[model samples]
Target: MSRHEALNPDDHRDLRIQERRDAALGDARMVCIVVPAEFRALQAEYPILFRLNETRDRFSALAMFGFENGENLYLADGRWDARYRPLAIDIQPFLIGGRPDEDGPKQIHVDVDSPRIATGDEGVRVFDKHGRPTPYLERVIEQIGELDHGFRESGDFFAALQRHELLEPFTLEVTLEDRSDNRLVGYHIIDEARLNSLSGTALAELQAAGHLEPIYMAMASLSQFSALIARRNRRAARG
Candidate 1:
């Protein structure tokens, strides 16, 4: 007689969206890390690195990160298989060129990649096209370029938030797939604020530094939100 164990199909089958809800939760947080203008020196010490432009005023570096899942994914270089490269040097006046801004980072057409594990800053992860967490850091650096320019132009680092919706209302969205069939099995949307509260320590550290901290939830009160809109309108009218 062949000895075969009777299996509970549901136990081994693909997870339903609700089945993973208890174990899988959506979460997101923002941090402001200071990178010195002379950041190239630190590259050799880490798994990543960069080379500077001729003027020495600017440099480029890689942005991959080690994630909880152990999968290190960078922006999918659709044209090239290369996963890690100096984002600044590789992407430039043509690929990421944007309308010039005196204060903000130059706007560029950088594709958003899925999040993955990061290398530094234990527990710090980045969001990608799908809102899933990953260790990818290049996207953040790209944002930094934009933020630097935006702040210089509009005098507010969060101007991108008001200009773009995809970047705002930050949240974590989980999408699970069956490896065999590549079918989506589960999904979840984690509120950024909920993640912020849970990551009080990380948020506190960012605040301690003089960085334009990101508030997961834009307005703590409705009146405040309204006031901001009124101010924006008034400023636009003056201009």
Candidate 2:
């Protein structure tokens, strides 16, 4: 269970967050939610795929990290190897919250139970001695705002893709050097054929809506699959 509390200087004056990346702090995940705004940067380092929500009524973008559950190949020696991390991942242990009636300004809430919460005086302080938010806290607030906005806007992107019939089911099969076979299912990728078949007007509409660039970026990100496989192979060799 998570214990979330509204972040405030008075309540968390001495709160320190451990700014380190490690599996123990919940960074070892095979995938992270991504937003179209981040596609340009994410495409350079990770394969961007789409998956349906549990209700099967919505689609969400994902940044693939590894082949299986609980495995993040980008994590090595307690550091994230990627040059850019998705906003969703960077805003850890903090989330936007509002009143129970949902009729007020959104406030920052922290998960007090998170392992990232430091137990000693060894981490980044959230507030200075005078109860002012430190620079680190300000950055976290900015990240939280960006993530919130991106998540809300993603619905439009997914709806556009569906309207244009541009998503297709994908299955990835990999054979490692040690003769191990791995199969990834239940993910979707942009349909290049359908994308190319779209009418000029359709392309124009997508471009006008600012979804065209990210669509191409997502397609380009597939090239990272080979790089991901290389990372996996390297990890296996070290075993």
How many backbone clashes does every candidate have? Answer: 23, 0
- What TM-score against the true fold does each predicted structure earn? 0.18, 0.96
Write model 2 residue lDDT over 181-218, tens digit each, in one string.
88899999999999999999999999999999999999
**What tens-digit string does per-residue lDDT give for candidate 1 at 1-239?**
12222122222122111101111121111111112221232222212222233474232222222122322222122221232233232322113244333433343332222122122443333343454423333545454464454334332322222222112222222222221111111211123444444456644543554222223222221123233233334434555
Cα deviation of 197, candidate 1, in Å: 52
RMSD of 2: 2.0
Give all candidates' CA lDDT scores: 0.28, 0.91
Q: Return the lDDT, model 2, position 209.
A: 91
